[model samples]
Target: MSLFQNLKSELIRKPNSGKHLPFVDGLRFLAIVPVIFQHANERLFKYGNLPELKGWEEQVSFLISRGTIGVFIFFAISGFILSLPFSRENSKLNYKTYLKRRWQRIEPPFIFWMTCCALILLVMQAYPIGELLWHYLATVTYTHQLFYQEYSIINPVAWSLEVEIQFYLLAPFFAFAYFQVRSLAKRRSLLIAGIFGWILLQHGMGWHLQPWKATLLGQLPHFLVGVLAADLYQKPVKWIRDFRFWDLVFSLLLLTLAYTWTEELGKTFLFELSLLGLLLSAIYGRYTSRILSLSWISIIGGMCYTLYLMHLPLLEGYYSFIARFGQWSGYIGQLSISLIIVLPIIFLCSVIAFRWIEQPFMKKKDQKSLRSNPIGKQVLSKA
Candidate 1:
């Protein structure tokens, strides 16, 4: 490759490290970008001098807030990706290797960043070094919820990561019956029952905060939806085929319904159903799938773990630098500034982290690469 080609290749995305799926990474890109903006919008409001929303801007802000659905998107993707090995016939599941790979893939970047965060806080005297160290240890263990009964004092985002760990540990068993059973109707009926079963259990007993939202049980349906998507993607039904533009349009409608339900219909199994339809439509739609599978979009999606780990801290830490110019437009203007200015910085910094901190831990192949029953990823009230 020539010089420009070399740099471009390196900059665009890393190498394949496993069984690759281009559109899924594209799906991740679609999911994560909104999450970055969601935080940027929140920061511009809470910490910046942006003027109040006028007219339809309030509606826009409401839409932006819903971007945290990226968290659940990640959950679904994790379910889809991790379930892949088991979803294949005659595929053997090795318990130890599966456990080890999950640890190796995500743990280092998380630990490095959290350590950096803890050291930064200690150096700044935000907390006593001893106390900070104690919290740091708790955060890495994915037990900060139990230790603090709150979001990690170290890194708030680590909460969802804990649920990722839980899902990682549990995914094999969840995926087994779905793929193992030869009878589609029998397996799918059971899957549907399991999803609503969790919902009904929550509805009947009432939900609790503290540790409950931080665990995998809180968001199990979304992950199950991903598993369902994997099943359908692998063994698609007779009528379930591509419709190109129509499929994309249908996905948009499903997304809109899913978005509006963010508040009132938030915890129901119905929400996961919408997400399922969205995933299937996006995948089976020929044009939508092609667009999602494009080199650039999928590559960015491929690096989402680094983005998720770093974006919030970067926004929170650096907002003051940009907040000075926050009064320019209304909410739209502040948001525009973030999209134009802040997002690039987040990406640039994250690319470095992806190249060094994350890629080193990736499988030898450099390819690409949530919560509820997991942490909801609502911006933390405090450390």
Candidate 2:
């Protein structure tokens, strides 16, 4: 069979959207795998280990820069997913339930992971219990970035978690802003104009730390694209479903040219636009013919959150322990061995955490409250 035929067959195998969107789960698979590869062997790719004209020792200088694109993909995916439920027919989507659901979904696993990290440090006598607890508090509250340069923050992967939490907190306000504009056509036009304007504004302003901080003009467009994708999904524009591959191919070529020039900001813009097109293509099932849908990849994608949270610290610990071997073959051998050891460990840890910890807390209906002064349902319901 042709590759497209194989891809179509695999996509058809997935259960339809009584659950989540299958193609999106597949998209998550794509995003998370790149992240893992980037984290694990980005150094190798940097030094030109993979197939190319360059020698291994003279690896490209800008390979780590691709990690920024991975992060943008993540932000865009999130903005789309988070906006999905709110854009539907249910005008009175209860904010309290939304908040509670988000809390239950996020807090338990995070707290568990942070506490586990603290306990490990304490037992190793690397830190006093008091200092560990403070670190734990900062991480649990998603303020780790604010204290990152100072405290013994456990999971640096969590910088994105801080962003995700901020998105969640501001979701209601964002929704309010969207709905306040009564005209749908005008709202969409405004969104289109805003997307272009934000990119230009960032370019005009240059790459100062201040725009990065505001994130409104910098990261907001990616997030807004995702939000707009969600809106489009609920009430799709028919022509979007007919989006031609040649258009995306042209976009991809433009993206490659930008990357080749080492234009970081231009790459971000091109990459985000390409990702947006791909996401729309996936949603409309236009590119269903191109998916591999590997069972192993889907399984790992399911555990991506856990792997994302744990991989860095786990890899660091592994690196420290491996340095004792002293006389290693080379970077390739070291990276391959490290990946072989780490992938299985990351998978196992994520599966166990998802089953034993994350699942119960994220039940559709809230269960019995665990705390004496649980953040009351009323506030949570507004979420």
Candidate 3:
């Protein structure tokens, strides 16, 4: 009993008592900034017409392309975090309750943000009101990804949300499957096989799926890696800590190979390795590192969702303005100046959105849900 108490104390030192994991938040920051940089790079390159300017365009393009790895990180993190709430109890989680919570958590922010985007587009006369209304409703339903035509009309980042929604829908089934497997090794084997089958299916069906759509299923491996990592966290695997350096090294090598190969399969393969390494590294590092544990990153990390949703609009406007009146001495100059002004404004907007929009709605929903549960009261009484 004393040994167990000591072990618990050693592991319980995470800031905020593990309610929020800083390394995961740091991963969020990593995912979001690269995505933003990628979008910004896309805009700059298109506007610059590939003119050389201190080689900034090339650098931005490289970083932006790599940002797709950020999506993998997001998926892995989601897989782990979403499973956390269910880990403590042996009570067969009420699927209805699970679905309801998922819906409430994701829908409000998504609907609100998409509506604002649609309204902006309407006011700008970007599309007809009749078509806008149709697309708007479709996006709200999270069915926009099903129809190829519907996708072009809405926020493009939502393509990932579409896949994420599918994962959420299946989480209950996944949890049930995990619980049914009495042996840890068997469960891990099943997950690995499932991921491999998904990849092969994507490859086999690539001819039928539009290239982008084909690439969409490629994200499943990363999500599975997250689930595996979560399982590892619940049951400590001593080898994970010992293998940290190798994991990091191999992950980097695979990523480099993927970029050099530049194939769809290459991207998918590297993403999985990078994500698994990232999780292991975070765990081994004690969730604190000079590179990722800084205050600014943690703060920005909190606002990642807002930043992701709003960046396209901000970048579009910024790009339009720059093209109209600005030309840099070279590509580098243009990119530097553009990023200098736009990044801070985007950051500021993300903070405001988090405070005024996301936080308020999240607080209301959580409070209402907590009031409705009252399970804590029962637990406390027993204690």
Give lDDT per model, in order. Answer: 0.71, 0.59, 0.64
Error of 3 at 59 (Å): 5.2
Off by over 4 Å in 2: 1-17, 42-65, 125-132, 147-152, 179-184, 199-218, 246-265, 285-296, 367-383
The number of residue pairs in model 2 that clash at the backbone is 11
- Give the per-residue lDDT digits (tens) of candidate 2, residues 241-289: 6666633453364345336323366655665566667667666544352
Flag regions of model 1 displaced more than 4 Å. Answer: 2-4, 11-18, 208-211, 242-246, 250-254, 257-267, 324-328, 365-383
RMSD of each: 6.5, 7.1, 7.3
**Please, what are the lDDT tens digits per residue for candidate 3 over residues 104-143?**
5457778888998898899999999998888887777767
Model 3 misplacement above 4 A: 1-18, 48-60, 87-91, 207-218, 244-267, 286-291, 364-383
How far in Å is the alpha carbon of 149 misplaced in model 3? 5.0
- If candidate 1 were superposed on the true structure by all CA atoms, what would the RMSD be? 6.5
In terms of TM-score, which candidate is stronger, 2 or 3? Answer: 3
Better of 1 and 3 by TM-score: 1
Worst 10-residue lDDT window, candidate 3: 374-383
Error of 1 at 270 (Å): 3.1
The prediction achieving the highest TM-score against the true structure is 1
Screening candidate 3 with a backbone cut-off below 3 angstroms (N, C-alpha, C), the clashing residue pairs are: 53-331, 53-332
